[model samples]
Target chain A: MKKVQDSSIAGERSVTGEFEILNQYGIHARPAALFVKTASKFSCEILVEKEDTIVSGKSIMGLLTLEGSKGSTLKITARGTDAEEALEALRTLMENKFYED
Target chain B: MNLKKALTKDTISLDIKSSSKEEVIEEMIDILVSAGKIKDRKSALNVVIEREKKMSTGMQNGIAIPHGKTDTVETLVAALGVKSEGIDFDSIDGKPSTIFIMTISPANRTGPHIQFLAEISRLLNDPATRQKVLTAQSKEEVVDTLQL
Candidate 1:
């Protein structure tokens, strides 16, 4: 039987980690904009994957397409220089619940 | 920041009489002014235009969210206008935008204003809600669709 992959990682420069959405409203326009703005600050290429779907971390539109409700698990990955820093920042944002009430 | 209060019949309009992107924004802001939502029309228009200069507020799927933070507004005031023929909002999708949501938020209360923008995004995302709002014939219908 064929099975689908929930998450995966490859390449030396790439760093990946899983984080759960804790905000009550999840990642809508405002939070997604904040995330994109943060991801754009780092030089590394970032991508966020939900289950098997992958989207550019720097694209506000792409992030919105995920329809990431609360409690959703997101896998974040980054590559290039400062990859570690970029991934850490994003993970921390999810951990901080996007500073939402 | 309250959608129920921010979006009223007086703020929603169907007959947006403007063609160009800049002019359309002028038209939308004028709605807020007439409704007494904006006291200083010139300053409010300038603030909204300044934000537009940085990046076109033209969102995809026939909607454009033009927003700015200024002290002229008491809290958060929103006006929704529909252009049946559509106008070039410089959207990333390269399509004409028919729905314009002009939001003027107070500078000090940005947190609630941001949450309101998120709410607008969620409302427009739903197929049923979007359709109803777009095809709304009366201002009352528009207000109903925006109600949470």
Candidate 2:
């Protein structure tokens, strides 16, 4: 099994990255806003899906609906002209826990 | 809506020729107006101003995204203003804003609006592309760089 979670398939504009929620409170309030704000800065369509449900990556309200707990693993996918950049941005944010404990 | 679908060739400008925040936004709105993307310029301007009052849309690294969501238009529209000299936009990073993407969308629409915003950010995130946009001599060059 490929332990790496940050790999993209060839020939498609879409890129995918997976990360586990590590923050004590998951993504709430400031973190969600920051996530949405960061996501909003890009031009690609980003999706953050957990389990089988998918949500728009740029909507704070939609992200909040996930109620992603501390251990929930998220599957982030981005498609469009800047899909790779969007995926990297989300990956950094999630890996760093949005820079919050 | 996809940025390419809404961002027409006429909506892009390589030179902003303005420094003030409001003036810059007005210039961008003008692009939308000429493209028939704006039905009410005054109302659309008012909405964008109101949104600024709520929070500064300026992103760091010399980028500002002034967006409005209202009935001023029934669909998503975008305009770009590139200022080589950069303008002080009160950005969170305190950097002069060189790229301003004026986005106007219908308040009732959902999903794609956020994606549009993300796409704009992602575009500027690339240093090479951002540099190309900043140095492009003409609107056509700017559009071509963005398409890259």
Best by lDDT: 1
Candidate 1: regions farther than 4 A off: A1-101
**What DockQ, between 0 and 1, does each candidate earn?**
0.12, 0.06
TM-score of 1: 0.67
**TM-score of candidate 2 on Cα atoms, chains taken together:** 0.63
lDDT score for residue B7 of model 2: 77
Over the full model, what C-alpha lDDT does candidate 1 score relative to the true structure?
0.78
Shift of residue B84 alpha carbon in model 1, Å = 2.6
- The interface root mean square deviation of candidate 2 comes to 8.9
Candidate 1 chain A: worst 10 consecutive residues by lDDT? A1-10
Candidate 2 lDDT over B1-148, as tens digits, reads 3878877778888878887998998898888888888989998999899877766777556877788789768778888888989998877657799988888888876445666665665566667888988898887787777782
Stretch of 10 with least lDDT, candidate 2 chain A:
A1-10
The fraction of correct interface contacts reproduced by each prediction comes to 0.00, 0.00
Tens digits of per-residue lDDT for model 1, A1-101: 11212332454477777788888768765567668768988998898889687888886656766767788888888887688888878877878888876
